[model samples]
Target: MKPISWCSAVIKVERRAHAVHTLRFPAHLPTSSESRLPSVTSDNEIVQNIIAQAFSAIINLKHLFLLGQNSQPASIKLSTLASCTFSLCSFAGQVSGDLGIQEQLDFLLKHPTIEYWVPTEPFLRSVNSFPTNILPNLRQTVLVRPSLMKALGGRPIESLMILFIDITHSRAVEYTHGSLGPDWSTIDIISNLSRAAPNLKILTLGSLIKDDSVITAENQQSLVDAVARFCHLKILVLNTYMCALQKHTDEDPDPENPLEHSVAWEGRSPAQARQVATQFMTACPSLRRLSFPDTGPSPTNSLTYILSGTKAKLDGFYIIDNSGWWLR
Candidate 1:
């Protein structure tokens, strides 16, 4: 929490707790350390102490955004998070485990009047499968995480977007796929969706990567399996990167070189993309339309693929056609 913003916001609303409805943590929550990293126990206590005190002054709060995944407090419910004893406890710093998605869910469950929930990494990382029946009024606002999807078992959701990226992970493009780039993180989430939101109408999923070749049509049968999990998934959008074919040699050019062989890669053709799209359409008979990442010979607007008979046509519709609805 930035002290300047906290001081200003508190000064403005210190006497008017009712005036504060939204509680959001910024992109970076600073601490006593120069690195500003999380997991610093003493530093985190200061943050937790400050946070625990605020809820008393914020009884009418609606939106509280926390997006960390450190050590979470065992008793993470509203009571412990806002109490004075929790503030002074030796283990007080462990409130919501570094930007807990679980904490946000607890907040959502407690406050039903909250209309819009912001996106955070923990929103997708939550595991406790809280039931939907607890608050029937929240039917439309359910934010789904992979493991948390089980909580929605036998429930329904209209729209959803699941995203995965090696953009900043150990498997990023800079890591060069480490080993054949077989680590697609979207699998388990897809499987959860299949059994969880059986009536999901519109869906979008992406495994954004630098080298699209890492997930070409050749090794995508598992993805097809995951997609088949949804009982009634209709309009679907797939965001992916298409790779151009590349070949490398294992030539040890230098005779005195200690190292032996070399390594390189592969790609996905437009034909391959079409094959995979058709696979998805076949996997989900309920699917009326689907969009795939474009394979590029030209950098033109790569369009969506919709079911036509047993195959998919590539240039008519677009997934973002309803982009305006996202603002609502």
Candidate 2:
């Protein structure tokens, strides 16, 4: 591979295309089971040195995107890149061992010009706690995991404009029986965003879990109230399953009164779902775009109400129901 001499660079080790004008370095470490394990120590040092050289080569870089899998470079390797002046820095893919979440945040903080800090994929093992100090120049953020919500708590991010909370990967396990779902405290963290990120223009909350372990009605209402606080929000994407109460079934039941034998499901009805959506639209008067999940024959009366009553001149209203039946 020839040395890169461009002012803007996008280096991807993986096949997938992520960010443009991004600088990605390979951080793969050989395991003991692999034949190259004997030379792993030397190989890592070489990779680090190459990364350092590459960082030095980019003289006038403005935006940087780092992509790696399974492992991340040590603090020293990261420090090399931090030395450069960049306005945006993004770390994508699974990061474990040496460079944990705190260290990654530290690296971002070191760069004084960084206005956007995006960490994609399963970066943190868990999003329980976060640094207290605010990133002075940070204006945009993408918290792809629900756990990352902890990062926004308490601190005032007055400049933050775009925020994305994608809990699809983390919410999968919560759907199983006996699982209580994600920490309810995360909701408080989000609610605080109204004051913290008062200027937030866009907010997206998506869940990829196919099962029925949906957010409780109480929490959903709380989320609506919290989001309503973002007075400047223009776009909102809410992809979640409404809680449905499971019915009790037995060998025999009265045909005359089936309602007598029915039991409450664990999830909420379509009406409750509409109520939550309506609250968000009503709260954020500046809202122009609204997106909801396409969950089969779910009622959309709430959306209709928003369109009829609100005078925000909506840019678009979308339903992302991937199920082929919706298309038919």
Candidate 3:
């Protein structure tokens, strides 16, 4: 009998703690110790078979992590895995192109039990649009870049509970003087999530920049309005230099100089933060926690004001002295 090749042997499944299970499938099988590549068709077939076998064997698996260098298997059903993490280059590099990737992604997202999904790949430029009804049962998602937002195309996921978006890469386009491509802004992201995931309970935003020159009272109001849509939010974390501010134009410039507008010129003023806290607390009656990394001195004051004025009771709030703590 012929032995299974390295490509086939690489298919492995390991059970981890808390009922979580991981399945690792190699994208390509090595023919020799030096250098080699396996037949795309053969490798894909083996991967599909292995995944099916693993799924059948691991009935109680909760968390599934897929790790591959450059590619992923095509259209493998995973309706049972509660959480899935994909760390692949593009969908399936050589085997599945743009169209194939989209089709495969659509199939994978159809899983009914998937609650948390983290696709570590940046959005593929070839794929222009995403399916409308993707991940109907998804509850939490961690978007690493803005391209992923474009890939999702603002698809409404009514079941979403928590969302963490990091847009550190797009800062050049959003803050610096540059052509703002299809990149999304904090406001855009919040608005899209609000409309799509109305039941969102926790939202954490990173790398939010507020250029006083560009952001005015009206712009800040827009942000406030967007946040009001999260009627069920309980925990809010803003890892930003500034909260959306009230728009102030040159003609009717802010009474105080922009430099002296607040303790932290680039950050939200106590008054402004208090206003936002009040509005958010009013809109989201369940809000119990608030956190801001860049809040200047008296971070708790604004939130405290809200607690005193409104009926909202905050379990706790934090004004992170160091920015690195929240990112960790």
Best by lDDT: 1
lDDT of 3: 0.44
Reference-based lDDT, each prediction: 0.47, 0.45, 0.44
The best-first sequence of candidates by TM-score reads: 2, 3, 1
Per-candidate TM vs. native?
0.48, 0.56, 0.50
lDDT of each residue in 234-315, candidate 3, tens digit only? 7776554343433232332135334225444343344455445566567666665655433432243223222444733332
Q: What is the alpha-carbon lDDT for the whole of candidate 1?
A: 0.47
Query: Which residues of candidate 2, in runs, are more than 4 Å off?
Result: 1-21, 24-38, 69-96, 100-106, 120-134, 144-171, 175-192, 208-224, 242-279, 296-328
Give one digit per residue, the lDDT tens place, for model 1 in 1-328.
4643573466457666557655544323554564354657865665555555655656555445433323322223344353321111001111333455555455445554433333333334444555564333322332323444456455445666644432113132221222112443555446656676777777776443434324444546777787787767788776554342222323322233211111211232334445556778898888878775453422223446777678765544233332222222
Q: For candidate 2, lDDT tens digit of each residue in 106-199?
A: 8656664555565544343344555555455555665434434445544333333222222223222322211123443334545755665667
Residue 162 in candidate 2, Cα distance off native in Å? 12
Q: List the residue pairs that clash in candidate 1.
A: 68-98, 68-99, 70-97, 71-97, 72-97, 194-229
For candidate 3, the TM-score is 0.50
| Worst lDDT 10-window in candidate 2 | 171-180
Q: Please identify which of the two predictions, 1 or 2, would achieve the higher TM-score against the true structure.
A: 2
For model 1, the run of ten residues with the poorest summed lDDT: 85-94
